[model samples]
Target: MDLPQSQLVAAHVQECNFVQIIEGLVDSSHLGFLHIDTLRKSDSSDLAYAQNVNSMQHALAPKIGVEDTAFGFYYAALRDIRKEGESRLQARVAGFIAPFTVLNPNGDLHQLVIPMTDTRSMFIHVYSASRRRSTRSRYAVSTCGWWAWTARHCSDFT
Candidate 1:
């Protein structure tokens, strides 16, 4: 399946090794705590990404399960959702493609970590939408807030 609409949302040099970037990508537990303020302030009605952020905030200690894939590995962050007195489980699965690529659970976002030197790496974020969807729509930009937050807070990001 080819995505007709795509954007290179962010390309920045991070003051970290590629391995460190990859480690951060696979660690889902950090999302709730590290981005608690932004996630809490997020408009949950905006898009699936916002909703997912809200979910992460609600469930900080999600059960993580990992499986080895042919190329690398995939992991699922399972969280318990209680709504209207009913309980359900929400699983967000993401993949780590060797040697430094992360596949977001939504399947539309991807992060690539390219090593620049011994202690530096290039971090790239890409967002893509299918032909049936408009790239300018809110859905495509759902994660822009997170990227913006990173850019604002990380001095090394540019």
Candidate 2:
């Protein structure tokens, strides 16, 4: 877990269950809904965050593609976007390690789920990310806070 390019400048902890936290991590579809204000479509000019509209609005349904890897599997979430009058595809890739670890293809973000007890869990996240270029979640604040907060336990699913 050593990246010469980056070092731990700081760290913190937040309130979330081990199961629910991972659930939210893999459930990329909720970005449009859960993070509507943040991840939702912004404008036509920004091609980096384009959208694929359907009958209702910009559709965020990603075409998930997975490939087996030595560690586990790597996956790509491809989304169609429109520019001018043409349609194009944008892909975001990420990889998972067995047990509970996820890495962004860019190598800028990493998250691990560590269970503290039956009800509390710790999300140890590392990022060498720039705010302007990185896609951060609203939940990021909690993942880096030291306060002893607790989220509803959803470990029953495990």
RMSD of each: 6.8, 6.2
Worst 10 residues of 2 by lDDT: 48-57
On residues 1-158, what C-alpha lDDT tens digit does candidate 1 reach at each position? Answer: 34334543656566576787787778877888778888787754666666666767777899999999999999999999776688889998899999889998877779998887877677777777442232223222223232222332232233
| C-alpha TM-score for every candidate | 0.74, 0.63
- The runs of at least 3 residues in candidate 2 whose Cα sits more than 4 Å from the true structure, single-residue gaps closed, are 1-10, 41-57, 130-158
Model 1 segments more than 4 A misplaced: 1-6, 43-45, 130-158
Per-residue alpha-carbon lDDT of candidate 2 for residues 58-119, written as tens digits (9 for 90 to 100) = 44677889889998777777777664687877666778787788775545667787777665
Residue 21 shift from truth in candidate 2, angstroms? 1.3
Error of 2 at 6 (Å): 6.1
